[model samples]
Target chain A: DARVTQTPRHKVTEMGQEVTMRCQPILGHNTVFWYRQTMMQGLELLAYFRNRAPLDDSGMPKDRFSAEMPDATLATLKIQPSEPRDSAVYFCASGPMSSGNTIYFGEGSWLTVV
Target chain B: GESVGLHLPTLSVQEGDNSIINCAYSNSASDYFIWYKQESGKGPQFIIDIRSNMDKRQGQRVTVLLNKTVKHLSLQIAATQPGDSAVYFCAEKDWSGGTSYGKLTFGQGTILTVHP
Candidate 1:
């Protein structure tokens, strides 16, 4: 019954504002991923971390978006000076270190930038 | 510019009937494939997965078939229920430049509707 938990399930902000989304991964899970879902783009992976270290962030917007796993339990995605085009559902998923691991997802944080 | 895709955007079926959703991947080097079900407004849930080495895999009432020769993947659900109505996405894992575990590339997805 373990699940990944995300905070601020819904967020509304004006353009140029800063938005922060938090996630609490399943206890003992080591891999965390952040993804954005939009009607046009579908689901796109933004970043991923393993063992509290950042593994990849190439998919993320280099200028405004950043993802970090501050500790084993908490991971966060932040957008500074967020734009209207950035509005979408942000999902956090966590999985094991083994191959063919099943990534479990959180309910997701819905963000709307006006 | 490369992408994975579903054969159909939508499919409708009866309650007792079986449903098949198909996906085609452009990457021949992909070694692993996974099927995920996403309910409206929810994240994708793991349904089943198959490796390139295997042609077919089954679990519960669901079966996944992989045709590597054609680069096609399908999900078959027996006795489709209302709860089984959701968007199904096929994802492929390809080896990254230096990463140990491959990164997942998802298909556009197919929505399934089961009617009683």
Candidate 2:
């Protein structure tokens, strides 16, 4: 079955380390989304891309977090000087913008920053 | 600003019993709504969704009810099983502009505990 794929399903890093998470959306999907899930906040949309172009990233902290879609197949979220508060499950979802607009989610990358 | 929240933070139901979870939203112009079920350590999975034009939608044993006048939403799970125990979130679509199709604003989740 075709589904959104995420790399480094589990990441453990110390504070101040640079961490990058990758996502491969399902083929032919035109919309890609990045979301962060934590105990305090459920699923918050961090960034959104349509047709490999960034449309919105206001939810992301500009200083330390960056999200980009270099091409149609790949999307990445990077965190520099990752802090302990950054520990959470980050999810990548993909779907079409037409009718229904049902987005399918990835397994998520569980990050633990100590 | 749109704010979506749940009426109850946690609800416990016995196995095989029917469960209903309620949600409230501040936006009345919002059109699309979705419900997601998330287990511990996992991403949220789509449960069911309803457009503003419709009042109710059913999928399998799950049902979503929307009331636009009061800005309320509810999920009804029939024959609740242990596998159905998880946190449920109600999300509303915020159309900032043309690029807001897949952008969803999620609400505080309701925890469902099914006891056998």
Candidate 3:
């Protein structure tokens, strides 16, 4: 079965370190989304891309977080100078626009910043 | 500001019992609703979905009901099993023809625990 693949399923980093999470969306899917999950905030959409173009990143921190789809198969979320508060599970999801709101999610990258 | 919210934060049920999870949305522009189940240490999985034009949709053993008049959504699971224990979330999407089209807004999830 087709599924979204995410790298670094678990990661532990010291504060101020840079963390990068990678994702490979399902083949033939054109839209990708990045979401962060925390106990306090629940799941929040950080950004999304359509056809390899950034659609929105308003939910992400403008200063430290960045999401990019370098190509159709590759999507990445990076945090520079990450802080402890950045610790959370980052999920990548993808779906075709024509699918009518059905999105598939990867296993998620678990990040723990100390 | 528009938001999606759950009626309960947690629900407990016995195996073989039926369970219902309810969600409410504030945005009238939302046209699509989805129910997702997330197990511990895993990402959310799609269960079922319903559109604004439809009142109910059924999947394998799950059903989704949408009431546009009240902006309410619900997920009903028949014959709940122990394996059904997970956090359930409801998401809404706006198809209002803008940059926000297809963007999903998820509600705070409700944790469902099934006692065997």
Candidate 4:
């Protein structure tokens, strides 16, 4: 159906390696969000984007983390020189800005950085 | 920072029984609250939501209660089933910021297990 889709459902990479997670939001969704979930921090919003433009990335560590929506159908979260602490489940969600604040999430990408 | 948090880390319920999961929010400015269920290896699924103007709202076999006075929220599941077992999370949105923006602050989830 009309559900958000994520690529590379699971990933294992060594520290200092580059990792990229991709998401395909549901059609017509204008707002996309990136979140990280860990046992210690729970679910935290890492970034927010509207209409393919980033509106907030305050929660993300700009030094290595970057989020971008190359097109309406593709949103990507990339980590350069990834560290062990970056290991966690990353989720991508999309929703309409005007409709009730309901965000539809993709299954999620389980990243393990050694 | 997380605006919502849970009072309990886990809850166990018997099949056909009712289960209640509680959450507390730190921001009083929050106007919309929602509950979601996440199964193992799956994304969080929308359960239900309630507005600050209303005290309670119900959907299908689930009911959400919002206590604006105490900044508390609760989700009640009627006749718990095995399929309902999952981690439940409560999220809040602050519309007082002047823009809905679809920003949702989520809480540390509570794991619920239904015993058949």
Candidate 5:
């Protein structure tokens, strides 16, 4: 079965360190989304891309967080000078807009910043 | 200012019993609704979905009901099992003439625990 794949399933980093998470969306999917999950905030949309072009990143912190789809097969979310508050599970999801709005999620990257 | 929210934070049920999880959405323009189940240490998995034009949809042993008049949504699981224990979330998408870009807004999620 096709599914989104995420790298660094678990990571621990010290405050002020740079953290990068990678994702590979399902083959033939045209849309990718990045979301952050925290106990206090639930799930928050960070950004999304369509056809390798960013559609929106308004929910993300522009100062330190960046999301990019370098190519159709690879999507990345990076945090520079990450702080403890940045600790959360990051999920990558993808779907074909033409085939309805149903999206499938990866297992997620678990990040812990100390 | 629109948001999706759950009616209960947690629900407990016994194996073989039926369980219901309810969600409410503030946006009347939402046209699509989905239910997802997330187990511990895993991402959310799609369970079922319903559109604004439809009131009910059924999947393998699962059913979703949408009450647009009341802005309410519910997931009903038949024959609850211990494997069904997880956190469930209801998400809404309002294409709004493609302005929303098919983005989904998820609710706070309800934790379901099934006892054997």
Candidate 6:
């Protein structure tokens, strides 16, 4: 099936460590999104890109978090000096840039920072 | 910041019964809305969506209802089964900024428990 693919389905690390998650969006999908899900905040959009160019990342902590689409087939999210509060299931989604297009999501990467 | 929130935090329904989940948003210019179902340890899965111009939309066993006047949205699952248990979220696309980047603001999810 032509679905979004994410790497390292699960990750465990200590505080102050660096973690990176990778995602490959579906082919021909020009828009990619990165989201984080937690018990308290639910699902929040961290960042998004259109045509491989980032449009808005206001939801992300600019100092510790960064999202990049190195290429059309690969999008990466990295967190440096990760804190325990950063632990959450990070999801990558892709779809068109229309008003309310259906976004296809990958199996999220679960990260635990102890 | 603009946000979407749910009315109920959790819901329990007997198997073979119908299930209804509700959500509310603050943005009046939201033109599109979508419903997503997320199971434990997985990403959210798209269920259905409705446009501002339309009041309702239906899928195989699921239906989405939108009330633009009240900024309320609902998801209805017919013949709810055990497999239907999940955290359901309603997302809206607010065009108030005049941008169509497909960015969606998601609501706090409602945990649905289906008991057989």
Tens digits of per-residue lDDT, candidate 1, A7-110, equal: 98999999999999999999988989898988778889998888988888888999999888888999999999899999999999988866667778899999
| Among all candidates shown, the one with the greatest DockQ | 6
Model 2 regions lying over 4 Å from their true place: B1-8, B96-101
Q: What is the DockQ of candidate 6?
A: 0.52
iRMSD, per candidate, in listed order: 4.2, 4.2, 4.1, 4.2, 4.1, 4.2
Name the runs in model 4 displaced over 4 angstroms: B1-8, B98-100
Interface RMSD of 3: 4.1
- Model 3 lDDT tens row, B37-113: 99999999999888888999999889999988889999999999999999999998877766787788899999999
With candidate 1 superimposed using the best TM-score fit, by how many Å does residue A30's alpha carbon deviate from the native? 1.6
Q: Cα miss at B106, model 4 (Å)?
A: 0.3
Docking quality category of candidate 4 according to DockQ thresholds: acceptable
RMSD of each: 3.7, 4.0, 3.8, 3.7, 3.9, 3.8
Candidate 5: regions farther than 4 A off:
B1-8
lDDT of 6 by residue, A8-90 (tens): 89999999999999999999999899999876677889998889999889899999999999999999999998999999999
The iRMS of model 4 comes to 4.2
The residue pairs found clashing in candidate 6 are none
lDDT of 4 by residue, A11-104 (tens): 9999999999999999999989999988778899999888999987888999999999999999999999999999999999998876356888
Q: For candidate 4, list the clashing residue pairs, or say none.
A: none
lDDT per prediction? 0.89, 0.89, 0.91, 0.90, 0.92, 0.89
For residues B6-70, write the lDDT of model 4, one tens digit per residue. 34499999999999999999988778888999999899999998878899999999999998888
Query: Estimated TM-score per prediction?
Result: 0.92, 0.92, 0.95, 0.93, 0.94, 0.93
Question: What's the iRMSD of model 1?
Answer: 4.2
In candidate 3 chain B, where is summed lDDT lowest over 10 consecutive residues?
A: B1-10
Among all windows of 10 consecutive residues in model 6 chain B, the one with the lowest summed lDDT is: B94-103
Minimum summed lDDT over a 10-residue window in model 4 chain A is located at: A95-104
